[model samples]
Target: MKSGMPAPDGIQPARRATIREVADAAGVSRSTASRALTGRGYVAPPVRDRVREIARGLGYVPDATARHLRQQASQSIGVLVSDLSNPFYAGLAAGISQQARKRQYTMMLADDGGSPEVEVEAAEAFVALRVAGVIVTPVSAEVSTYLARQQIPVVEVDRQFSVGVCDAVVVDNENAARRVIHQLLDLGHRRIALVIDEMHWTTGRDRLAGYRGAFAAAGVPLDDSLVVTAGWDVDAARIEAHKLLSRAEPPTAIFAANNVLAEAVWRAAAELNMPIPERLSLVSFDDVSWMSLVRPGVTAVAQDPVALGEAAISQLFERIQSPHAPVRTVLLSATVAARGSTAPPPA
Candidate 1:
């Protein structure tokens, strides 16, 4: 029976053993028993064994609630992402879940639906849950300040966080973008255009830097008019492409920053009666499942979201185990997959 509760008439008078009971049975101080059970601080190996055996014999499961109350931390982890509908993010979430499962940890997943307010709300929810750690691919840099003030371990995935404020795992967006541009330049296309989302995010910004770097290296002057910014949606990109193509001088090659933008660019080219790899060349940042099935296979920079996700989860757990350790940054590599969509520009 509990300290102040009476056993019901039909219930047996079995009682849950407290930590003090385990300590008494093991012939050790309560503090020593706690150290032994938590594997924290210092406890002799023999004494730890005795405490474990006593705990087992007494059928005593250490009260996680009580431990959390004392430590002020929950063992749960929180994952916040921009869009669940994107295949890349979905794959990343799966990998994170798999890694967490292997480590005997649980995850709480939230999607911001590409909204800044939603992202803040998700972070606040994680704080309310008292999660041990947080993994996020933020919508913007504003989230850094919002989350950092919470005094929790946070790992930023696929994006850069504020300097010296949080750990991060990201791909080499600049190198990947440069590779795509070099591929187009190799195909004898001089007037190449780049379709991208906002440059506020690290991914977009680095990709733009890469694009400019490649052009500079190739002795091609940067063309501000050729770089078009659009939302991360096929329809939005298609509308933007229409405006670009209807201009007096259109591009001979287009490098779309992501899968959705690539699809829209392709659709616009088809509508304008522009033959891919003949009248125009096309390449994109990410390779989606349906990339190969399109009329002209999309040449793309492909990064393994699964591996990125797994690495992020691994890093987060490492931080959990050693909270005061040095901040680590992991950069995943990407490969340019050549396809039928790129060729020498029309003479």
Candidate 2:
């Protein structure tokens, strides 16, 4: 064949070269070529070099999927998150990807958009792909149970639904919420509104518990009407905020359970002409860029999402290495960023 030309045996340039071609060119058995290329069972240095040179010349590439199937384990790990658009999830995914690359493993990512059904589907897809393990911010316990039954190593991040069944990495949500709420109470805020999306998951449930705990600790009675379940939609949260602020006995302060609820509260306060920390105090569980950039920075409980992601991956690798080992749950602490948004309730 001419230089840079396709093989004369009808093999097109675009066609993937196979191990058989490499073996034939190297004048070796397929097993010998595979051992040399994969660094498996030993082959003579000279013979290995010769085989590699022939593979390079023929543009031969081994199929990782095929190799993984034969070995019954993949070098790829699956990561499933609720929402990629949220900065928290984005940062978490970046951390996971970085750690995965460092371990010479490929990452397969899936966005479930915060839907339990979608999360389950993604888990099934990961199984079909033969991923060596999974790291997920689970929406429901079903995903974890499914993966556990399949014998796939799983590490949960951000939230935990499968305690004792899989490893997990998360912030101390309940304590963080209690600390932020205590700050609001110390500012002489009597009537505080607790705004959250849902209590179905541990994140929201723990945060709500903290809010109530803070009130009880302060000898303050919580008004059931002040606790609003705004659901996951931002628009719904905004509407809920409007209703809360418009009440005859509107809260003097608002404790938003997450970043989304925080934004909704901010918007509602603006629409009602209630300037933050002036007419009404505000606090949030998660920190966002705008939280600090606004005229009066919003006080928040800042969780290290990236660190959480990295921890999840580290736990995943441990599970992969020792599948029968005891499951671990890592809890990272969240710090309170006391900004201008929180202060003594208006006189």
Candidate 3:
């Protein structure tokens, strides 16, 4: 076949054109052709134009895999979250995607459905892909340790496990929880119940600590019966809430540690025909859309989950750029958005 012409019938189709073919057609060295095409190094304008024209004519496509290998970095990042169905995680993923697009990086997302085993599997897959870095809402320390051992840059978001071993971006869960619980305490809520999901992760652990701290500051002995570990789902929380409300000495106020638990508390109150604040006071550690739209808006710690995602991406890029730098933990602040849900205990 003639140079730059389609293969003749009965002959096997020719392989895709490479830089060598472009260089040959342009009568230039491979390095010069590369410099011209990538606009990286020095090449005369006439030579660059000739090389580009030849590349176009020859259908030469640059190999991104080879280029990434040469640069020792991929153009993609991995993002792992506990649940994408939750608006909180969805917002976080959006923030990460926005920042990644701005930086000319692609994101590979993995949802582990709140399972620690699944989380570890996702981390292993990311490592196998040789992603530039990872941002994860970790379920277990094993995933973080595995990534760190592989010399991968990792940034823990929302929840952290590898403290002092990796970068982290999280809100001040304990302080925010303490502040909101203190608001309820100041309103004369003595028998307040704390509804929580998982206590193994920092998100739940810190919030629980803050709850205890608030009661301690007031010199009130904690009643173990008032603390409810309602699994991770709204249904589980609802059942636990029913049990709490059925008790003869039921709590007059409820502090839900997350949006899901908050929703369960609200539903349980509704089913029991309990009037909020008048019959039972309610507060939540995380706010959601329905919280504000409801008749009596829930009192909650309003955290910027989107901002948290952005911050996690920023930290991951920093870690990728400076792998040997000292590990850093960024703690953001959440504010209480008090509405009509919380009030003094009923007489």
Candidate 4:
């Protein structure tokens, strides 16, 4: 391996082909080769095809970072989500990737695990990478505030923390939740319970408002005790749900605010040997896969997460195009997928 010594097998790692090499081989200037390969400028058809063929044969790949540096702009966007392990987030990310690619913008995706420190770190990294804009389901207002200070356009997805200060794309949480409760009320469920993790975010707060609103619309008083604050994990939620179901005057129906909570409730019901709809009615806000795989499909408020992602990218692109435009909040709709999970209370 000494310098210029005979190689063991006369083999060597192939060097990456550069634009200059391609230009020299194609008998053209570097700028013309660039224009021909990227189709960014005028080039005659024959010359363009010949240059492209030579570039391909040489396995030449353009340097995106250098191109962005030359233009003083990036053709990339940053996407930050709370949790990617969740199917909802995964679907949303997939949709965003598809839409961003369609517009020729590369997406740089990150998961913050709902941590403020991690989110701040990601924000700093995005700025360092020279991303054109950011789309995030922020853990707090700080992410948007920091990006705004950096003069980077941002769009919040799924939930909002900065309100009018940032663009957002979210579903009609209140109306969708209210409609879910209405269905329960119409079915004569009086002592209904709501199992939720926290009321801190716009998602939880709005859904709670809708839950209470439904009772108000029905002229029924809400029992505050029934609003159980469960923890984020499944075991914690299951314990809370078990306690609620074990009450002497247990509710006839339970409304789980999300899929994880719904899973906890379902597991608790199974442990208690309660036949769903026959004794305890279950409704979930998220329509996940397992909800339908069960014997009795869970009644759910279905949000099109893929469409949600598409909407977020669209909003982010708009923000990037018009940084001075008025901030906007686009609210998409959800539908009630009434399955076999809900029924009139026993007797």
TM-scores for all predictions: 0.81, 0.94, 0.90, 0.94
lDDT tens string, model 1, 1-347?
46756547436426888899999988899999999988999999999999999998888888877878888878788999988888889888988999888877789999998887888888899888788888888876667567668777888998785646788999999999998898788777888998998786888999999999999999988789999998887787899997887788889899888878888988898899989878889998988877889878888999788888999988988988888899888889899888898888888
- How far residue 26's Cα lies from its native spot in candidate 2, in Å, is 1.9
lDDT of 4 by residue, 1-347 (tens): 57988776656435778999999999999999999999998999999999999999987889999989999899999999988988889889999999999999999989999899999899999999999999999889999999999999999989899999999999998999999999999999999999997898998999999999999999999999999999678899999999999999999999999998999999999999999989999999878888899979999999989999999999988888888889999999899998999999988
Q: State in Å the error of residue 258, model 1.
A: 1.1
Q: Name the regions of candidate 4 deviating beyond 4 angstroms.
A: 1-13, 43-47
| Candidate 3 lDDT (Cα, 0 to 1) | 0.91
- Which candidate, 3 or 4, has the higher TM-score? 4
Better of 1 and 3 by TM-score: 3
For residues 1-347, could you state the per-residue lDDT of candidate 2 as single tens digits? 56877557755565788898899889999999999898989999999999999999987879998889888889999999999999889999999999999999999999999889999999999999989899999988999999999989999899999988889998999999999888888889989989988886889889999999999999988888888899877788999999999999889999998899899999988998988888899999899889999979999999878888999999999988898899899999999988999878878
Q: What's model 4's overall lDDT?
A: 0.93
Q: What total of clashing residue pairs does each candidate reach?
A: 0, 0, 0, 0
Error of 4 at 209 (Å): 0.4
For model 3, the run of ten residues with the poorest summed lDDT: 5-14
Worst 10 residues of 2 by lDDT: 6-15
Ranking by lDDT: 4, 3, 2, 1
lDDT of 3 by residue, 1-347 (tens): 56877556636535888899899889999999999999998999999999999999877889877888899779999999988988889989999999999999999999999898999899999998899999999888988899999988999999989899999999999999999888888999899999999787899899999999999998988897898999888898898998898899889999999889999999999999889989899999878899999979999999878899999999999998898999999999999998999888999
Candidate 1: misplaced stretches above 4 Å? 1-67
Clashes of 3: 0
